[model samples]
Target: MASPAGTTARHGDICVGLMSGTSADAIDAAVVGITGAGATARLELLGFGTMPLPPEVRRELFLVFDQAERAVERLCSLNVVLGELFADAARTACRQAGVPLAQVFVIGSHGQTVWHQPERDSTVPISTPSTLQIGEPAVIAERTGVPVMANFRAADIAAGGQGAPLVPYFDWVTLRHPERSRAVQNIGGIANVTYLPAGGDIEDVRAFDTGPGNALIDGVVTLLTGGTATFDADGRLAAQGSIDEGLLARLLADPYLNRPPPKTTGRERYGLPLCRRLLEETGLPEGALADPAAPFSLRQRALDLVATVTAFTARSIAEVYRRWLPPIDEVIVSGGGSRNPALLSMLRAALDPVPVVTLEAYGIDSKAKEAMAFALPAHDGLLGLPTNVPGTTGARRQVILGTLTPPTGIVPRSQGKEGQV
Candidate 1:
């Protein structure tokens, strides 16, 4: 099936986007068909697929993420391995969409973010702000036989921005409503928000990390379940208990919550170490919970801890809205945490009066929204356009983000690896 005329001289509108969020769980690949460019660009969601990381691959990836005594060999090997994983995801998504891989013009891989520092590191003498996302573009391009765009943050950092919350551009372009102010809140491992004023231009948008999302809550769940469970399924355990008011109050007082916009954080702040501390302080059982059937009193304590963390995440998000965001009618949510019932219920309670809705209301997959954020920006990149929201990232000026890795042209994309990852 050939594309109609004027759908670009070459590859038509098909493009693939790959995203692995702070959770390090699966690679989300979104196959989008973008026509025209910029705000007027029309988008079609052809297909979406999630490729779970192999357990061993995920473990090694975390070793580099959490441990200080990391090996360069591990980092080097994992980078290529992740690229292979990402390529597999793209292929799967394209096939699912009934689109040939070679017909897709480009792939936008946000890669796997191992470390991101929104603030400068004063310990280094030079004191330059920095961020790192691996899964090299060259590797993806080589393996998938497609042009790739990646390393989307470094350009913004070079321009003195925090290089975070770049998604505000996508929110403004794709989501801004005609008559009402809206907020797009993504509750990935790290929660972030984009506030779009009514009929907002690019400059009217404001965005920043609100606080911990599934990162802390999921970390605690993993601790309780030993290595068996990756997340609290549908917030079941949390629904069983009560929140510890005293602990919730203390966590709410975190200065990062009060910190202004142009901010971001990752495992460095709310990862395993914080979860371990919380578990130890709460006196929860450790080592394993394959069968969490415990003495009633002990089980109650564990449930309370889950409830407290869930409360903390909801409270922090609501606080950001109360303090920083201007009046808005709708709070549209996305990301993995949005699927957590307990989190959404608490969020709805806190943001009473303002309707809390999922991105599905707008007719898009909430889970694949971030993956699309990267894809559209890659389109803008090829068009030589700037998509970064200067106010959100504190960049001096709007600039194009990401580096392009053209295909090696050694093999046709359709002939690339099919079944194996």
Candidate 2:
């Protein structure tokens, strides 16, 4: 294993960034090159890849994650399974990139988040304002033979922060420009934005969850289609259904949409139960809603749900910009939500004259953006630099995020495998 270098060292390094967002779809692994230090941080994207969870695994994981009460043994068992899966994804990315596992310096895995309760107190079952991201770093390291840096959010929460919107640090590094104020909006299972002012200091950055990215849409689609569909692909269903204006208004009335910055939420608040409640309140359904049910024709209802969720996400982001930041020059979007034409159309409509661009326009793949974000923090961890932005995570003070898992042994390399070819 490689040992941590002294603070003054400045050597080129390669780090693998792994992330499984709120959607719980797959693990995104990105290889990034880090150079320079401190205020002069520089990043280069070497390669990237995504390994999806099997449909059954995804369903089981989501069930355990969304349910309030789950068997402790099952949760613990899944943690190890997830770790192995994460390692497999990382190794697969390495093979595709033609990079040797031994050559890579660090692996930064965001892990799979089962639950995030940042509002908890002493009396709560889980102590403190805690968050849980399984997939042990030790398993990743053992499988890949590389030092792994996991659990990036715990330190931030410990410092009185929300432990989310951590991507803003990377957004600041990758998108901050002297000429324009740019907003890097990621529409994942939940939508969030990182606002970088034109020529702004670190303190000027703003980030927060914009609510319900693909979460609600996916929920409705699954419920309506009887698990035959995971989502409303390309907004086809939504395009076929008319927006139920009354339900849309009711759905948008949730207090989360109106909350200020530095907030975070997940399936705990916006999952199937909430969707069912919304339907009931609108006098739409009774009894258990089954997929592929006749008479009610959930297809149209599902479409309406997708359209409304997309619209809500876009409108909330636009509202945030209008309220907190300066005139937005461009909105750079990324993640699975970006692929949804209906969502993008709604976003453009909501933002009006502001114009939206995908992260691809700036040379960052939308699916890999969050993984790359972890790379930035991992780089900071290795360098002893503060990774959290006080303005974004609500941390009392700036702190370097993540732990360093140094390489265990130096493996002698063959002639053809040594160094970057």
Top candidate by lDDT: 1
For model 1 the local lDDT of residue 73 reads 76
lDDT of 1 by residue, 143-169 (tens): 777878899998899898989987887
lDDT of 2 by residue, 253-343 (tens): 7788777778888888877777666656644442223434545565456556656666766676777677666678999999898998888
Model 1 C-alpha lDDT versus the unseen true structure: 0.84
TM-score of model 2 vs. true structure = 0.89
Weakest 10 consecutive residues of candidate 1 by summed lDDT? 412-421
| Cα RMSD (angstroms) for every candidate in the order listed | 4.8, 5.0
lDDT, candidates in the order shown: 0.84, 0.77
Q: List the pairs of residues colliding in candidate 2.
A: 1-407, 1-408, 1-409, 2-407
